[model samples]
Target: MSDHPFDVLAARALRVGAYLVRADDQGRLYDGIGLKPEHWRRAQTLLADAPEPWQKLLTSDPGDDRIILPNGGHILRLSSNRRGRHEHTILAVIEPCVCSKPLGQVLSESTEADSGCTNVTTPGQCNGCAAACLSDPITVECLLRCWYEDLFKLGRQESELTKLSQQLAETYEELNLLYRLGQELTVSGDPRCFVQSLCQDLLEVMSFRWVAVKLFDLPELSEQLAGMFVCEGTTQKTINEAEQAVEALAQMPQVHKPAVVLDIASQWGHLLPALGNSLLAYPLYKGETMYGLIVAIDKDPEAGDISSVDLKLVGSTASQLRIFLDNVTLYDQMHLMFLGTLEALTAAVDAKDRYTCGHSQRVALLSRQLAEALGLPPDRVERIHIAGLMHDVGKIGVPESVLCKAGKLTKEEYEIIKGHPEIGANIVKDIPHFDDIIPGVLYHHERYDGKGYPHGLAGEDIPMMGRLLALADSFDAMSSTRTYRAALPRERVLEEIQACAGSQFDPDLTPHFLSLDFSEYDGQVANHKAGDPGAQGVAA
Candidate 1:
């Protein structure tokens, strides 16, 4: 597990039993290849009892220079331990190291140790091998150089390992940053908030001195993003100054790809007052259209100058912003496309009853307001608004004679009027993506008291869309002029709605419906009247 190739070579080249010992405490032993525990303790005592010159050999640091000890012992320096004390790796002569027999056999046969052996030298006659194997230092100098060479290799390995560790850490940080960016990409709607968040996050991970994004020419983004500049991190510059830096980036004709500008004062001196010492910028563009720019100016001094990794990150983030803008553009186009078709169909229905010139548009707008007031989710509220535009499509099937009689309807003509809800429902059911609104169209005429129309679905049995649409439909119908009756005043309409709450409409939704601002509705009515001179008194 440890890196000690030099330790092995130092022992083999010297042909001595190597043991690691603390230079401060010469009596202690660590790694002794073939030496017994008692052999080490005996050898330590012998060195202690020997002449002061022998004791000095164990106490002093060998430090690349080889040291000789009693019984042909050799010592070399290894790096210091974590405790700051030098570990002297010694290759020493001992009883067990002189022969091939096990270390225990040699220690038991020793006769001049502990009691009578007081001097440093302790050699013994082996039963199977020679008494001593002292190393030839001068002869093995080249191999000893290999020991130093091996140590050099270890140093290089440690340096490389340290470098690799830092790279792996940086890679992990980049992955985490990308993961968070992915979350924002999928869920966020506000471009201003998204860009501001991106700047703050990049500042923390990339250690930039200042981070900022500038947006322009993106009509799909909400108007809130007009003249928007999002930034994070501290610099002497104000937001206007930051915007100037971004403007410089945008205006730079050569910056089509992600690139860095080093020595900002020298290379981009024009922007020096607004920027840091260096800059990394990535332009957000789609095809030939440029949308925005993301810039990071001057990295943290501790983080070093902006590197290639920083440039790549800025490029990737810019691409994401471009994607968000493209998505918004596509979605807006599809939304307008969807409304275009329904607008044409509603126009045909309006032509059959000239008095209700913009009745469908008004009902749709009013229903949208009521849906918002009732706290419906956006998707449902939007569907309700579109559904309101086609709610009276069945009126296209009724005879114009019955619709605009301008007189009391006979029994047969009135029944024909009552069948319009079913006709509207059938017509909408065949239209793609209009299935969700059929319940609303069919049951809009059904009353709360089980007395008023085709299905007579009373109270809670009615679908929620139907229940909601009922209030908007009746409110517009009663408030607007019809061939049979004049338009009611606001106060009279409000009182009639309040009185009919329990039987004609859902009592729960009546309050929220009554709370709507009719100013827009009044404006819509006035606009329709201006467009069609007789629209005010026609049947809606």
Candidate 2:
């Protein structure tokens, strides 16, 4: 038979064909097949004219025609027509290759070719039927083509799979970084640190070139947008470009509310060619109030020119970051409003009588110091500070006659004085974010040891902040000149605080209250106490 393509090509493809026809399919056989050699077209074309049933011979059932291969104990099958018979009479029998497998696999010994009968085709007899198949020329050509096509496809698939795996690894890394940034933003309380950390994460993980954040400053009744934070990549020069674009939009006589440059490439709307000419901005808003804008900048000018994938990522990430910014701004603003209302209430209380100006401010300072001394977390300390400032809020409801009385109050008047804590709690009860502080304000007068007034909460039952504030409120009251008494000396005030520990104050926090350094605030206290008569209540 003509030589197979396996005989002519590189060793790898030839080894693959050799392995596929092994006697028992053992080790080294498959490796031998993978190392098969390739043959040229000139060689393959000569074999294509041969007349073996090459397709059936290579892949058909072994039972039909079996040739026990020489020396090696493998059964190979080939079926062909018998020669010199009636024109085309077929004698189906297994036949082995006549040529030595020096170009294929090694054999132990030369074997006789299988024509039809076993006796005539013994190991010692004649040439194999491959001689007959080779002389015909059609069989060898078809088999060579089949093997080559399969190997090419397998190599291509392996290459593609490797690329897909690499891409998946990169995507996982990006998601992990985002998750970590989310955790940091959730735990962090400071807005500036939170935003700065977020920006750094976007630049490093998401590959954003430039990012900027702005906040609304209410100069009048209307909010004026101001850029509070901006971060740009080292490579990118378009810093604050988005802000300039928004500012330009605001200046146009045609648009009223702030205009967003959603797609910058378009000609009709706001355009700034300098700002990388590409923009994405999400409004930081809470209800009707516009807090600010978050802008993500890229250099691509045409919409089609920018990556749709990257743009989607920027939009989603910006939305999440915007929520965080809006939340923090709302929290800070509400805190300010709480302080403002507290001031108004304190002023109303002072308006009832001139004797206690800046009373709440003093209480607030002392309460904060005491809260710190107790090693409270900053969040709790903040709540305590607000509670201290607004503790006297209920006093706003007290009558002027009772507040300014110079002598000891009647039993009826003391009852009216005792109602302020409840009144203060009631006033701020409806305000969100003030609920935690309400207990401290309403219950500051309560005794830690169950001996004080109002609910007379005992021991740990009194809130730590309320207990701390109780000491501050009591000490400040004694230290200040009231309608009934002259101001007490610092030494006497410290002694009184020590005496009331565990009884009127949380014993654990009393030492901190006594240790407070009064020097820094002494002048401010004296100045506020020396209220200008002209400074009446603030306008509603």
Per-residue lDDT, model 1, residue 48, is 52
Over the stretch 256-334, how does candidate 1's per-residue lDDT look in tens digits? 6677887777877765568878888887776776667788888878878889888877776776677766666666667
RMSD each, Å: 9.9, 14.3
Alpha carbon deviation, residue 111, candidate 2 (Å): 25
- Residue-level lDDT tens digits of model 2 in 1-540: 123332222222222122122221121111122121332221222223334432333334545442323322222222122333112211111222334333222111112211111122222223543222221112322333343444445556777988888567656655765676678775237566666776676556545456666555543112212446555554233445555664554344333332334455674343555444455555544566555555555633433343544444555566666666655556666767967887777767766766677778778888887777778888888888888888888887888788888899999999999999999899989778789988877888898889776887798888776787788788777877777777788788788789977777778777777788876446647567456554322111
Clashes of each: 1, 31
The residue ranges of model 1 lying beyond 4 angstroms of the native Cα positions read 1-212, 217-280, 295-305, 396-401, 429-435, 526-534, 537-540
Clash pairs (backbone) in predicted model 1: 355-538
Residue 374 local lDDT, model 1:
82
Best prediction by lDDT: 1
Candidate models: Cα lDDT each: 0.68, 0.55
TM-scores for all predictions: 0.63, 0.52
